[model samples]
Target: MYQKKVKESNKNNIFKYIFEKRKSFVINDIAENLNITFPTVKKIINSFLKQNIIFERQKVGFGVGRKAMEYELNEEFCYSIGILASSTKLKFILTNAIGKILKQQIYELKSNNCKAEILNSTKDFLNTISPEVRKKLIGIGISVPGIVSEEGNFIEFSSKEKIVLSFIEELKNLFHIPVLIENESNLAAIAEAFLTRNSIYSTFTILTINEYVGISNFHQDSLNNTLFFKAGRLHHMVIESNGKLCECGTHGCWGTYVSDKVLLNDFQKYFPSIKTYNEIFDLKYHETNIGASLIDNYLEHLAIGIKNILFFSNPEKLIISGNISIYKEYIADKLIEKIYKNHIFYRGKETIVFSSLNENGSIIGAAMFPILDKII
Candidate 1:
């Protein structure tokens, strides 16, 4: 019985490995890459076919022994729902196992009313979607703007608002499927890693500077999700001995120096005419040194944040994200330059990279949970 179970597990791993490499794969190539006997690979592929987890298509290569049989994940096999609850908005997306969006819903709400707003928004979102898609969904992934529990519960908020944990349980019970909840920063990092599967740099950290500064890390082995989330709640890292007071009563938390609130406050003081971040971007074209200085000063504190992670996790790369990052070009290089200048010995050379996933990284990360669920 144990041996039978082991065989089954091995097949599952092979399937997962192929699915992760890309959206599709060929039989001979999968066997070679997974280092499994050709017969075993064929058997596993047949099993996946029986389960409707994968399907095969004939492709004529430039030159091949026979028409190659290309195996790809069945797009209709399952679905995953992603909820990105941000400080200013709650965006919901329903996607297939491949992270392709089938539908999306967005709602604007006050940050202070997060708990109630999130619950209402989710309920309404489900109601608005087609029943057929909802029924096929294997799981729901919630990416909250605040800290989340290891058990997939939203526990705390970024600002004064609190994240209601009960909604998670409610969704699980209502949908009758697994529900995974995580911090939005963690979701962004996961999405970033998914897009850069070709890079040798396995460990990565992503910081999103939106209405709040959010952080998360990913290790090479893909087990970094939970571990990094536990370590990156930098509400109080104590980077400066005599710095500005933080909301958490710390002398110099990273958030104190580099949060959206601080930047907007400075903008209001200096560029009082500017009403919104979008307006500033449109009007200034980000040419004003004053705004650049605000970003530079924030980057200084951000460098300290990266330094702490470098000493601790030693990630191979760092990615700067969020709404601001999408608009601000050359931000990643400037951040790395600041870190190298301040550090005693520069170790993170060419390790920092800009995020390619853009603002949708978090949502895509949320979409990955369903693919993972189907495999497990």
Candidate 2:
């Protein structure tokens, strides 16, 4: 009985140590790190390997002793699905426990018939993945353009009766898996926060500049805290009482002045022939004249809205994502400069960071949501 209890104690300690590292550790490293004997560590690891609870990989070193091996938590045993929906398109991606993408698909969408199109797209994307893989899916995480409650409820008002009525509810019934819905900007903020090495921001704002700008503030107790989602319609925040008309039925709304739509409009006025943003981005000569100056102005306009958010949230970090995040160095400096100019009392040196998770961060964040939730 004493020997059995001792073995159990050692096993528990090994498990605790692995989680504390938050990253993979080799056998010798784990043993030394935990102050446990090598033989004991080897036995525990071998048991875990046989049970397929952990994965092992070969490691090489020049230190002469037979190069030790490395081990990490196996992800293939679990699965998750992430869906990112926007006015222009929808991205569906599959991932495993280690946050590796197994497969993904992007679909062009029409805003007019969004509900049916979104549902069909979801089904089609899921169908593409093998049925055997689908059986292992534990949950689905969705990133939508508008606000969502803490429990993954869609609170933002919509037009389609099917969606505005009970689309999320129907999906839950169909899938019979945990479905988590979140604001797109909220996902972007978390992705950018994880990418930052400076600090884990519990309170921060994320600005995503697509055709229209979407903003959201994230407030949480810790890195593992539940995310608070608040709608930040900077585009609808009035800049001038009698300025340009906005799509949200408000005159002089910020969106009329500081959205990607405005940039596209500017491009049309000058070039008259340009059809799409991709075309504008692809132009070579635009690097000197139109592209550079337009991007500069867009940055200036974006700062005005960010300044407003700062006044309220006083967030320690501001993350910028989506297509606009590509020109981060240029835009970030511009936003910081304008914020300093507009708010003299803002002495707090909040770190402004860019998303290193690529343009598809929302999808990855969504995919990781389920896996991390289970592991934690």
Give the clash count for each candidate.
0, 1
Error of 1 at 175 (Å): 2.6
- Listed per candidate, the RMSD to the true structure in angstroms reads 4.7, 6.8
Candidate 2 per-residue C-alpha lDDT over 1-376 given as tens digits, one digit per residue, 9 for 90 to 100: 0001112356766754564454558887877877889999999988878866577887755777676688876657678889887667788888875456888888988655766776788788878878888887878888776665434434452212224436677777876777766666666665554434422555677777664567767665543334454656465788778878776766887777766668777777777777865555654624758777876676676777777777766667767777656656545676677667746545454556676664666777677666545443
Off by over 4 Å in 2: 1-53, 57-70, 75-77, 98-102, 110-113, 149-166, 194-199, 220-231, 282-285, 288-292, 342-345, 348-350
Worst 10 residues of 1 by lDDT: 1-10
| Candidate lDDT (C-alpha), each | 0.69, 0.66
Give candidate 1's error at residue 72 in angstroms: 2.7
* Model 1 spans > 4 angstroms off: 1-8, 50-52, 61-66, 110-115, 150-154, 159-167, 198-200, 220-229, 240-242, 283-285, 373-376
Instruction: Give the per-residue lDDT digits (tens) of candidate 1, residues 54-98.
Output: 887887478747786888778777778888876678899988877
Residues forming the 10-long window of minimal summed lDDT in candidate 2? 1-10
